[model samples]
Structure formats: C-alpha cells, structure tokens
Target: MTHETRSSRRNFLAASSGLVAAAAMPPALAQTAPFLITSATDVLLPKGKAQRVVICGGGWGGLNAAKQLRQLAPQLEVVVLERNPVFFSCPMSNKWLVGQVDTNFLTFDYLKVSEKYGYRFIQTEILAVERDRKRVVTAAGSLDYDYLILSPGIRYNYEAWFGNDRRAAEATRARFPAAYVPNAEHFRLKQAIEDFKGGEIVMTLPPPPQRCPPSPYERACLLAWHLKTKKIKGHITILDHKDGIRPIGLGFRQAFEELYKDQITYVPNAQVKEVDPFNQRIKTAAGDFKFDHAILMAPHQAGDLAWKAGVIGKNAEGKPTGWSGVDPLFLNLRDDRDVYVIGDAVGIVSPQFLFYPKAGHVANRHAKIVARYIAERAAGREPAYSLPDNLCYMWVSADPQQAINVQFDYKIGDFQDKGKVILQTQIDDNERRPELIVEDFRWFGYMREDLFG
Candidate 1:
C-alpha cells in the first residue's frame, strides 16, 4: 500500500502496454495509459466501506445483474465496468434498422442505470483479469473485487469464414456489415440497407451455437419486407447453413413462402467456402453467389474479456465453446466460487442435452438467478438452485406488425448430474401472428423499464 508499491504497479502496467511513461501515447490508449494501479489506490472511485462486486460489460446480462444485486444486497459495492458511454439495446435493434422504430427507442443512458441503481459505472477498456490476485486490470488501472461477475458478451470469429484473410474480412465488415454485434456495425449496416437502390442483396448464416439462432432469418424477412414495401426493385438471396428456418423453422418457412415469396430467395445447406469482399462475391457449399450489397455474419465466440479472464469452457464433446466455464446450474466458475458468468458468453454445457440460447432474454434470466445466488452466499446461507426461463420474439412483418416467439423452460432432469442440466422448450402458437407482435413490443417495453430504471 506504500506510494513506492503503487508507483511500481503503475510502471508495470504502463510497461505491459509497451509504453513506459507514455506522455506521447495515442489518444485512445492514453485515457487509461493501460497502467496497472494497485488496489490500495481508490482509482475506481473511493472504495467506500462496502465489499465490492465488479460486473464486467454493460450489456443485457451485466445490467440485469447490477439491478438485482443492488435490490437484494444493498450493502454490496456494485461497480459496472463498460467501454461504451451509452447503452444500445440489441434486442429491438432490428426494428430500428427497418424504420419500425427510431434510435431513441433502442438507446439508453448507461451511467443513469448506475446512478439510479446505486452502483458505480466505470468506462474503461478491460486489459486483463488477474484471477490469482482477484483483481481486474483496466486501462485506467486495476481494482480488486470480492465477487466478480463477467458478462462480456460475444466476439466475432472471422477466422472460421475469413480464415487468415484479414484483408477480405476487414473489407467485408467495412462495406457490408452483418450488424449482429451491438456496435458501429449496426449503424453501418443500417445505412447500407437504406442506400440500396436495387439488385441482388446477399446474406449468409452461420452454423449452430451462435448468438440468437433465429436472428439471421428474422433479418432476412425484414430485409425482404423493406424491399417489398419500398418497391426498391431489389431481391434478397439468403444462403443459409441450416436446412431451413431455425429454432422455429416451420413457421419462418411459412412466412417466407406466404409473404415475401417472390422477392426473397432462400438457399439451404449453404455453408461458406470463400469470401471475396472486393468483388462482392461468395462461394458456398450450395453454389456461388454474387450480390450488389450484402450482410455477412461470422461465427461468434465469447467476448475477449471472457477469454482474458480464462473462464471459457467446452461442450459435451470437450471442444471449446469460447464461453465461460462454470457450474451449469449455479452460474459460478468451476474453480472459483466468488466468480460468475452469464449472458451470451456462457459456455454451452451440452449441445446434445439442453443448452441455453445466446439471446438477451436468456441473459436477463441469467442475471436474476446469479444475483440471488451471490446475495444468498453473502448472507452465509446456502443458496437454493433456480433455473432461468427464456423467451425470444422475432418480428417478421413491419407492414402488419406480425411476429413469432419461442420459450425455453429449463429444469434438472431426473438423472441430472453435477455440471450437466436438461432443458425443456415450448413455442406459443409457434407461428407468425399479429397478436404476438404486440406482445413482443410489450415485453421489450417492460424489460427496458426494469433494466434502465
């Protein structure tokens, strides 16, 4: 705790960033200087008298965890570390892209969530997580945590599709964005879709275990809808890896055929082979396709922070899922009880059995359960196990405001063992309907109020 030790830590952190006494560091890196400040220094605000619980990433799961943790355990010092200044909701973002709603509907105050919910919000890029030291290294400095919850979200796996072709990957992302990630890609993709005058619009879908299984198809429907409604004289060609629509395949296929049959072309079993972004061309398993504009989705992995924290686990096959390795039912790391993970970054326990979908709804449910367990453990009580209920709705039509939904109910199987659990699913009226669209928006509204309040 001496000044000498603090100075050493700062010097060490700066050196780690390859910049010692970096007075001339770049503007972005200079903010935090990537310095590792000792925990003794109250850099993340005055530590106060409460035991600190640090939640990484300010997305759906992290925000929900902060909200519930503050409600259940008023004494804990909850600090949310996020890189972004404002929260942009990805759940209803598709609606915003198609002009069904405005930007205000999807944007929320990130710091306000902290202010209203009695937590400190720190805006800093997470550099590393020294689990052995029970501290998180941020660009600003480092802070120790009594309990840590990581919900850092997903990272794109461009390697699967683009491989070592970094140039092609960068070009594709720059011109034709997938908009799957909740970042600048959203805005860029929106502008691309609007600026389309006419021609073949190409879209690609990745394999299973990706975030939001039904999202690609839902977006296809919306894109087709935009073309039809606007009379843009454009056609959409969807090269899907799966056989048909996913999660709710039957219903989505019905929508595609009945609604946008002429304007949209659905190609199945079309795995990606090669991508030539400069030429607006792609070769798939099904066939070769070229387009005037495109939306591309690379496979996804857990966020970099999750990997940096070293919590990524494997599936039943013992293959890396690029997500947090944790006790399936408890949502805590296998090796450390004080650390937990939720949201899309959570590793799939068993692909054959029942795995939680990487969706915002599932993450919200995950936050509530994780909050309760943390609170119970803090109170010196053995926490009871509870499962998350996940429901996701996709809007298929902006004209009639029609949508479809899927619900998953998770429970322990009779033969369930440690680190493995079973899931039960239900689809309500499992088809596109006008009534479900209202329910979808209503659910979105209620969730926003609960989270952003």
Candidate 2:
C-alpha cells in the first residue's frame, strides 16, 4: 500500500471503531449437527413484510454486510443463514492455538450480534439456492428472498491431493486436520500440537489464492516457537507448494534462518503427488516423507454453498474455477441483479482481481462496498464502483510478541486496463515488528465491537 492508500485504509478502519466487546462464549444452542436448527427456532424465522436480503455465512463478510444493510436500509429485512451458532475468528486463531489467546477470544455468539444489530440470523444448513425461483432451499425450508448475498467462505479441495479416493481424503481430514476452516478444525489441530511428544511435525501449504496466504507459514513459526519454548524434542518441516514465502517473503525467511534454523526446515515447490494418510506418509515432487504428525492443508475452493447455489464460474476451457461468477467491481451477478457472492468464494476473470487472495480484511471491505451498491440499487439509483484495500498480519514469534505485516492498496486502472483495479503493495523487507501485532489485535477487536457491541 502506498502512503496515500495506507491513509485511506486507516481512515476506513477508524470509521468502524466502536467500544471493544467480546460476547461470552455460549454453549451450543442445540445439538451441533448438520441440517439441524442449532439456535432456537421456536420463535419462528423472521418473516419481514419488507424486501428481504439473505446473507449467507455468518463470518466476517456476511456479518458486516448485514450490519451495513440494516443501517443503510432499515426497511430491508436482513437475514443471515449460517451453519454455526457461534462465530469463530479465523484471523487471530493462530494466537489462540499457541495459548497467547483463549478460545473465548476466537468465539463469538451469532445471536447476540443479530439482536444487537437488528438483523435476523438462522443457524440452519443452507442446502442450495433456487435462483430461478428466487428462494433458498435450506434444511429449515424454502426461503424467498428479494436479494441474496453468498459469502460462505472457502472449503478444502481435497481432490487435488487425494484424487477420487474419498476414503483417503476423509482419513487425511480426520487425522491431519487443517485448522483454516475454523472452530472444530482449530480445536483438533491445537490438540494435535499439544499432544505432540514429537520428533518431526510435517506441515504442508496449499497453492496460492487460498484464504490468508500467510497462514501455513505463520502456524509453522508458531509451532516451531512452541517446540523451542516447551523443550519439545521436535522440529517442523514446511512442505511449501509455492515457490517461496510469498507477499512477505523476506520477513519469514529471515525468521526461519535467524530464529528457527535449528528447529524448522523450509522446502519450496514441493507439489504433492500422492498421499498415504493411513500410513502417515506423503509423496511430493521433491521427495517422499513420513511424519510423526502432519498438518495437511489441501487446495482450496469456494465453500459448498457456492457450488450448491449454482454461482461458480467456469474458465475459458470450461473448467469450474471453484469461485462465483460475479461482477468484478460491484460483486453482483452480471446476469442476475438479485444475486451476489462476497468473501473468499467470489472470483473474477479480469487481470486485477484474478487470483485475489481470499483474506478476511478484503472480504469485509468487499461486503461493505457491495452493500452500498445494493442499497443504492434498492433506492432505484445507479450504483458506483470502488476497489478494496487490505492488511495481513502474521506472528513469527510468541515469545517476543513480534510479527510481520503486509498491506495491499488498489486503484482503478488506466484506459488500457479496461476499468480493472491495479494493485499497489507496501511491504518493505517485511520486517518483524512488535507494533504490527498490536495493530492486528486492534483490527480484530474493532471489527468485533462494531458489529456486536
């Protein structure tokens, strides 16, 4: 991000500043299961007389969109359909895993946020979207919608690693759980980390454009830190699928060499060829390896809801891109004004947004920008377009409380670029600084307070 871009981003963040508050973690409102109402539905789902907007997914994107819509158009009934009753923060979860933060720090109640912001939230599985009939077919029932915003986030594409072997994929998911998906996965991974009476913990990274580009490396650093501090008889091996530490390479590389050289092994471009999860072994392009424990991050795709919604786009070769076909700038379906896909599930073919990193900060900004467009269109006004800017933070050490930061700013391209956005990145040497972590806390805390406080 340039100086000007950074200032603008700061202003936007400052605008959302509210009294920081974290809701008390609640027990499961009902039995935690699929296709079931986890929250109390005895009161009945809100049947608003006005135009209804259903925001799918209760994570960062959907929740922010709900908040904005209620404020922008109070007459519009905003309903968010999410599978989980409690909201979990994937952003700060690495901190949680290493005991720097508690589970309470990562969990928030959806009902409390819904009530506080005057939006309706239903904890029911979203089966599919009936776009032609203008309704959502869910476990609860068919829900008619005036407008639908899909923001269900990312899901692992296990097929990339496991091929057609369902059992292998499931076994890998069960044994070497990747914690990127939130809540349960995080719990499983955390337990695995704690239980490691270890020799070598193997960690793998998925290819680019996945949610939070820095997550795997960050976790590796934290895991190494944990082993170093706890005097655990182990080291970490990062089987990176990419060429190198991306976006903020120098920072991570410096840390790897200076701080964790004795405890971490960095391997680049280790394209996974085959997996033998049952035998606790994997074959990658570089070599074959067996592990005492493994954290396997499979390739990513749009969440199931996006596929079920029939919004996923196809490439020029007719292969499914595993992301929604939506207007690059406005985030609305080009063919259907009534449908929009936000967050990590959204994709574009243009040069600017193609392979845009599916991170939460961008999703939050993207949702709000789309909310304005939706509100303006609802008022029968022509909507304007704007690009998004974001910041990503990673913790390389818990002991010194130091971290690395990367900022991205974007602007509408010139005449030759055909209205697409151009990226401006600002990460000089990617130094690990203590202040960066503080800003990270504020970023997470402010977002929590803005919607739930």
Candidate 3:
C-alpha cells in the first residue's frame, strides 16, 4: 500500500468506536494477548532508511511513548535507553513499603517490554544530549535519532538541603531513605519501620513540585495503620514544608483527624534547615525534631541529563530553575523541535494554568500525546493534539481498604490571540471508599498493560 493509503487505513482503525471500546476494556482481557498493530504499511526500510526515535528513561512515560509509537507507526525504528535493566514503578510502591504488596509486584523487566513492542532496549546511563547532531551519548556509545523523547524523571536536590557539604548530604540520604523513587530505599524504609520498637517516626515532606503530590501523605497514613495494627507504641509525625498536605489537603487532613488522630501528628511549614543523620535528628524552621526512624523526602529537580544538556538554565535572578523548558503546546524544547520533554522533567509553564502534578498518571498521559504527535508528523500531517489529563488515587488505610481520587483537566483558551492555558481540578468526595481501592488497582493494571503488554 502507498504511504498515504496506509496512513488513512491506520487512522480509520484508530478512530473506530469498537476499537476504542476494546482499548478501554479491563486489563484482564487486554493482557491475554499483545495489542495488535493493524497497519498494512510493511516495515520496508531501505538500508537504514526508517526514521529513528529514541526514548530516554524507561519509566511510565518513556515506556508508554515507545509502545504507542510502535502501535501507531510500526514501520518506524524505535529505541529505549534506560539506566536500569528492571523497571520499578514509583506508583503504588508505598503499598510495598507498608507490606500491602510484595516488591516483585512493583518490578518489571525492560527486556520484556522492549521485545513485546519491537523496540531496541539499551540499559545504559545517558551522558549527554547532542541536540545539534540529533544524537544522544550514553556510557556505551552514541545513538542518532530523528526524534528524541526525554522522560528522564527527577533527581533529588541534596544541595538545597545540605548546602556545601556534599558528603554530609550523601550520608543523610543513605541514613534516611526517602523511598520516593523505586529503589532499594523502599525496602530500607520498610525494614526500619518494622524494626522500630517504639518512640517517634518522623517523615518530612519537601516543598512543591515533588513527584506524586499525595504520596507522602499516603505513606504517612499507611505507616500509621501498620503501627496501629501491630500494636507498636509509636507516634507518626509528618513535617510539611508547604502549608499542609496539598492537592488532596482537605481529604488527608480529614483522614488524619478522624482515623489516626492519636497516632499521627502533622506539622506544616516545617522547612528543613539541617539534617543530623548521626544524631537521628532534623533541624527545621518549625523546630528541631528527633526520631527513632525517618524518611526525608528531599527537594527534587529535573534529571541530571537536563542540566547537562543546558535545557535547565538560570532564571531572571540567576538561580537554577532545575527543569527543562518546553513548548506548552507540544512539550517540545523551545530551541530544538526534534527534542521533547515530558513527565517530571518538564518545567512549570504557568503555575495557575499549565502546572501539572508530577505523577505517574500524568506521565502516562503525556506519553500518549507526544507519541500521537510524532506519528502524525511522520505521516506529514498536522496533528490534532488532545488535552492531557491527570488521574491519581491515594490509599488511606489497608484494613478498611479505602482510597481518595483526584483528577485534573486542562484546555487552551478560546481567544487565539491570548493563547492562555486553563486548568480545572476535582477531588472525589472527602469520604474514602473501599471501591476506590479496587478501582485504584484496576487503574494500575490498565496502565501497566498500556505500557508493557
């Protein structure tokens, strides 16, 4: 089939209501088989002639983008570069920490994901992004790409908390496991919690723009639940840098007040001034607090690759912003159309209208949008970009199996001249429900299948 005819056929199939409905079916049905890519266009590359796409980071965003790209345009050559061989999801990992789920359930094989989607998977650390040459340099070798999607994720900003003492910062991180990222830290935190005989367990929430806005609160709640169930004589203390646990502030506040009032103590605006890992204490603006166990959610910034690429630059006051600048419409770098930034790495455009929570659900939705845009561009068409949405669920307790849900919607303004972006947010009723917990698992299952099945 001619390229145009092939594109038309694929578009028709994608738009079919039946196919759309099938795509929305539960994960149990969809996971039974590989998602069929029904493009008649054969993978007829004439000696390295296909457009090459490189996806950096194999998290929810990059993996989903690769899968969607292959589903939309299988003829194109796609590659995924991930630092780690195994993909451990940050979403719902708190459950693993609280003993709700096993660690194996949070991990997946990158090789399987790549094989299932027919993409080259390379486990290598990215050294640099050669934007002018449209190539990425890894520890192993340099890779050229026609298009690059960066979902490099976030890196903890230790300097912000520890100042000039790099060694002290590293020591602090080692001593207190954040467990925000999917790593050995989760197990460390779990062990610490388990070993705690009594006294206080202090968990600090960093300032805004952290991944999974509601996660720290969720962790606090679940940990309190664990302690309560175990009859451990311990009080869980939450120190928040912000005014309160936000995005789902009201809901979380109510949860703390009603359920774990005796076991949980929440102190807001408790910014960290210094951390004494040796003494097992944190000096914050609110006050100096000592703990038998601690999990410090340190400040976070865009991945180091972004800073190395010069995409993350100083602001007007000559302070590092620690995020990549991308076009609000396409998530493409302002200076380089060939490069796109998504997920937590994307800099805030406008906090009022364009800001999105740094969450896995947001990243998954971003992957779809970027993948569709790239597919349309490859087909020589102006794509109809879809408005990205974010859906997040936070569990409140384990025994009762209750959770809270939040959704965010965005749209461009009606006036073409103004080009203002608009945002709308909704939180499910403050009352947590067992059904929401079931739906949370269903949501996670669908997301997993969408990216790796």
Clashing pairs in 3: none
lDDT of 3 by residue, 19-71 (tens): 55547533322221222233312221112467888898889899999999988
Ranking by lDDT: 1, 2, 3
Q: What does candidate 2's lDDT look like per residue over 198-271, in tens digits?
A: 78778888886788888788888998899999989898889989888886899999999998998999999998
lDDT, candidate 1, 349-381, per-residue tens: 543444578988888988999999999988889
How do all models score by TM-score?
A: 0.88, 0.88, 0.87
Task: Tell me the alpha-carbon RMSD of every candidate.
Answer: 6.8, 11.3, 10.1
Candidate 3 Cα lDDT to native: 0.80
Winner by TM-score between candidate 3 and candidate 1: 1
lDDT of 1 at 37: 43
**What lDDT score is found at residue 101 in candidate 3?**
86
| Candidate 3 displacement at residue 65 in angstroms | 0.5
What local lDDT does model 2 show for residue 223?
A: 86
Please state the error at residue 65 of candidate 2 in Å: 0.7
TM-score of 1: 0.88
Poorly placed runs, candidate 1 (over 4 Å): 1-48, 314-319, 351-354, 415-420
